[model samples]
Target: MKVGLYFGTFNPVHIGHIIIANHLAENSELDQIWMVLTPHNPLKKKAGLLEDYHRLHMVHLATEKFEKIQASDIEFKLPQPNYTINTLVHLEEKFPKHEFSLIMGEDNLKGFHKWKNYEAILAHYHLYVYPRISESTIPEQFKDHPHIHKIEAPVIELSSTFIRNNIKEGKNIEPMLPEKVWEYIDHNLFYRK
Candidate 1:
């Protein structure tokens, strides 16, 4: 099985996330697209992040309907400041039959070098990049890399930050997220700051 690992905090999975996952599963060579919910990203700030379990549940709600798309909390059991390379290594050990690949946005590529063992990631696994609306070009260094492939997945300008802000301001985010996810957030009073 060829699995595309879409690593995220999923701080609250939104439509944009589903869109990308669905696009990759349907249009790409990947058989499955797992939304790897990272409990922590070493290079990112954890200020506004919700509890790991809540974020994981929201992802579960958001992706429940898709058979090919799954919500994985594998990182939850891993060490803090979870590194992608470490997770990849663990995944390979656990799922020996699956070929794992990394799915990321072109915007992330700008800072790819900063990630731990990024070179190993590039050398060992395929990277499927979706273009962000604002990032018009791939970095010069990776423009011709055979392991990196650009995917023309439909881009939704909606962001989790935008949705979170709307919720904080008491705005309706029904259209921005899956119905179940919004209901989960509302019922649980999440992000009601």
Candidate 2:
């Protein structure tokens, strides 16, 4: 099986996220897209992130109806400050039968060189980069990476931060998030000030 690892905190999974996953699954050669719930990302902001359990549950809710998508907590069991390269190594060892590829935004693709063991990652695994709102740009040196491919994602401007802010401000967010996920957030008081 060819699985695309879509890693993120996903404080609360939004419609935009669902769209991207579906778009990739339908368009790419991937058989499935795992929404890897990262407990703590080494490269992202943590100040506004909800608890990992909360995030994971929300992802599970959002993707419940889609067999092509999965809510993975692999990073939750790993040590703190998760690194992509290490996570890839672990997944490869654990699921030897399946081939794992990365699913990231084009913006992240430009910074691949800064990541730990990036050279090894490029050499060993395939990358499926989707376009973010930012311009899709790859550094010249990385243009020839053997196993890299860029994909065009669906047009959805909504982000997790925006949803969280709407909830905190007592604004309507039901339209922006998956119904199950919105219910979970409201029931648990997630992102409430």
Candidate 3:
């Protein structure tokens, strides 16, 4: 089956993440979406990240109800400084039976050229991009990249960083996340030190 690899940190999966995955699964040709949780991104600071297992568990809890969506901890075992190209290459080798593609947001559109082995990725994989409200100023150079297609899924501006900060401050989080997601966060005391 053709699948979309929806890779992210998913430090604590929220309603927005689930909603987008469901939208793609329902509307797109993808059979399912695997939420590949990255343990560490080479380009970003690792200070605020929850443990890999915990993050995976959060994704597990958040996506429990969706048959077409799954949480993956594959990156936890892969070599560090995780890059998408390497992961895709590895998965293709391991699961030749399942064809895989990419799912991402528009914020990542401009930066795609800078990733390691970007050319190979563009040539090999089909990228399914959702419109991200935060990145309104994409450079003109990124306008016509090959293999990139914009999806019409409804967008949400909510972010995990904002949710994490709200939790740190002891603020109400129910409004920002789904009821089940809130329960999972509260049950695990995630982001509450």
Candidate 4:
């Protein structure tokens, strides 16, 4: 199976995330798109982050009905401060027969050089980059790299932070979130101060 690993904190799964995942699965060579929920991302701030299981559940709720998208807690059992290189290596070892590709946004590509073992990631696995509004251009050096491919997948400007801020401000978040995920947040009173 050729899988596209879409990694994120997914503090709360929003429609934008689901859209990107579906677009990649339908438009790319990937047969499956896994929403890899990171327990702790070293590069991001920890403040306001929901518990791992809560975030994981939100991803599950958002993607449950999608045939191609899956919510994964693969990083929960892995070491803290999860690194992409380590997770990719582990996945390769666990599923030798499956081909894994990294799915990310164009914004991430700007900081690609800062990631740990980025060269190895570039060499070993294919990178399928979706366009984002900001910093949409790929660096010159990687523009023609065989393993790196930029895909024009449909994406929304909506972000998890925007959703959270809307919720906190008592604005209707139904428009920004998947129905199931909004229901889960409403029922559980999640992200309330």
Per-residue lDDT tens digits for candidate 2, residues 95-174, read 99999999888788777889999888888889987777776578997777678887667767778888888888999989
TM-score of 1: 0.94
lDDT per residue for candidate 4 within 1-193, as digits (tens), equals: 9999999989898999999999988887899999999896556777779888899999998998999999998888798777899999999999999999999888888889889999999989999988888945677878889998889877679889988888888889798888988999999888776
Identify the candidate with maximal lDDT: 1
TM-score of each: 0.94, 0.92, 0.91, 0.95
Candidate ranking (TM-score, best to worst):
4, 1, 2, 3
Instruction: Give the alpha-carbon lDDT of every model.
Output: 0.90, 0.86, 0.84, 0.89
Off by over 4 Å in 1: 41-45, 135-137
Model 1 residue 174 lDDT? 91
**Candidate 3 ranges with C-alpha deviation above 4 Å:** 41-45, 139-142
Each candidate: RMSD to true structure? 1.8, 2.2, 2.1, 1.8
lDDT of 1 by residue, 1-193 (tens): 9999999988789999999999999999999999999785556777668988899999999999999999998998898867899999999999999999999988899889899999899999999999887735667888889999988878778788988889999998898888998898999998888
Q: Better model by lDDT, 2 or 3?
A: 2
